[model samples]
Target: MFSADALIQTSGNIVGGTAGAFLGGYFAIKVMRTQIEFQRKQNQQEKEEQYEKTYWLMKLVFEGLGSSIDDFQKTMNKPDIDDKKDYPYLIGLLKGTLSVSKEKKELINDNYIPKDIYREYLAGITLFNSCEFIIERWYQTLHLDNFKISTDNYQFKDLIVYGNGMRHIFNEIESIKPIKKKVTTTGGGAK
Candidate 1:
C-alpha cells in the first residue's frame, strides 16, 4: 500500500539507524580502550615515582647506618681494630643517629608500591630495621640487661650480614627495568 518513494524512505531510515548504532558502539569501545590505556600509563608513572622515592630513602638510610661505624673506623684509621672491643662503643656512640621519623615511615606505604616489587622494598627496609634493632639491643644489653658495657660484635655482625645481602638484592632490584613481569613456564606453571 505504500508508494515507491515512501518505501525507499523507510528503508533509508532503517539503514541510517543501524549504521548510527554501529558507529556509536564502535566509538564507545574506542573511548574505553583509550581510557584504559591512559589509566595504565598513569599507574606506571606513579610506580616509577614511588620506586625512585623509596630508593633514595633507602640509600640515605644505608649511608647513615650501614657505613656509620665503618666510616668511623676508616676515619679513625683503625681498620685493624678488633670489632669485639669496639662494636658496643660504636653502637652507643651512634645511637642518637638511629631514629625513624614519621616522614620516613610514610615512605614505606602500601598504596604506591607495585605488587611485583614489594619484596625488593621489604628487603631493603628489613636491612634498615635490622640496623635499628641491633643498635637498640646493644643499648639495652648495656643499660638494661647487663647494666655494664659489654664489648661484643655479635649484634653488629648479624646486622651487617643482613645488610650486605640487602644491598645486593636492592641493587639487583634497582637494575631491573620497570616492565611487566614476564614468566617462562616450563610445563609446571612456575613463574
Candidate 2:
C-alpha cells in the first residue's frame, strides 16, 4: 500500500518524465530537420558552382577553337605561307585550346546543365571533337619528309558551317540564370 503523499509524488514524477521524453524527442526531430535542410542547400550551391565552372570552360573552348579554325583557314589561303611553320602553329593552338575541354569533360553530364540546351551542348562538343580528329590526322603527317599542304578543305568548311550554331548556343547558355536547373525535373513525368 502507498501513502497518499507518496502516490502524489509518484504521479508528479511520471507526468514529468513523460513530458521530458516528449520534449526531448520533439527537439531532436527539429534538429534533424534543420540539418537536412542545410545539407540540401549546400548541395544546391555546389551544383550551381559546377554549372558556372562548366559554362566558363565551354566559353573559353568555343571561342579559342573557333578563333583557331578561322586562323587556320586564313593561313591555308596565304600563298607565301610556310607549311611547316604556320600549319604546326595553328594545329598546336587548336590542340592546346581543346585540352581544356577534354580535361573537364566530366562536368558535361552533371545535373547542373540546363535541360533545354543539353542537345546543343552535345552538338558543340561533337563539332569540337570532329575538328580535333581532323587536326590529329593532319598532325600525323607532320613528321613525313614529303609533307605537303593538302587541299582537303572540307573539314574546315564543315567547322565554319557549325560555328554559327555554336555561337548561338553559347549566347543562350550565357543568358541562363544560375541554378535554373533546380526548378526543372530531371525525370520524365509531367511538365
Candidate 3:
C-alpha cells in the first residue's frame, strides 16, 4: 500500500501534467492562427501593390498618347499654310509618334504586368481605340478628318477621352463605386 504522502505527490504530478498539456496546445493553436492572419494580410498588400503598378502604367501610356496628339495638332497649325504639300514630313512625324507609343505599350506589357492582367491590357487598348474614335469624329465635324491636318478640338477631345478612361480604370480598381443590393420582391409587396 502506498503512503499518504506518496499518493498526494502522485496526484500533484498528474495535475501538473494535464495543465502543461493544455497550455502547450493552446499556445500552438494561437501561434498557428497568428501565422495564418499574417499571411492573409501579406497577400492582400501584394495584390494592392500590383493593382497600383498596373494602373500607373496604363495612365502613363494615356498621357503619352495625349501629348503626342497635342504635338501633332500644334504642327498642323503652323502659319506656313503654303507648306501643306509636306506629305512625307507629316508621315514621318506620324510614324515617329506611333513608334513611341508602341514602345511604351511594350514596356508596360513587359514590366509590372502579370499574365492575369492581360485582360486589363486589352481593355486599355479598347480605351485607346475609343479615344481615337472620338478624335476622328471631332475631326470629321470640323472637316479636318483628313490624315493630313490635325485640329485643336480633335486633340482636346482625344485628351478628354484618355482622361476619362483613366479615371474609369482607377475607379474600378479602387472599388469606389457602391455595390448594388438585389431586392427580393415577395408577392409584389414593398418591404
* Candidate 2 root-mean-square deviation in Å: 9.3
Candidate number of the best lDDT: 2
Q: TM-score winner between 1 and 3, please give it.
A: 1
Candidate 2 per-residue lDDT, tens place, 134-156, comes to 67776787678776655466665
lDDT of 1 by residue, 1-191 (tens): 88999999999999999999999999999999999999999987787777666656655565555556455444334545544556566655657556642246456555665667677767766776776776677677764433433223465456657656555665666666343444676766548
TM-score of each: 0.67, 0.68, 0.54
List clash counts for every candidate, in order.
Answer: 0, 0, 0
Q: How do these models rank on lDDT, best leading?
A: 2, 1, 3
Candidate 2 achieves a global lDDT of: 0.70
Best by TM-score: 2
Q: Whose lDDT is higher: candidate 1's or candidate 2's?
A: 2
Which stretches of model 1 miss by more than 4 angstroms? 73-93, 100-106, 140-152, 177-191
Q: Considering lDDT, which of the candidate structures 2 and 3 is the better prediction for this target?
A: 2
lDDT of 3 by residue, 2-40 (tens): 999999999999999999999999999999999999999
- Model 2 pairs whose backbones collide: none
Report the CA-based lDDT of candidate 3 relative to the real structure. Answer: 0.59
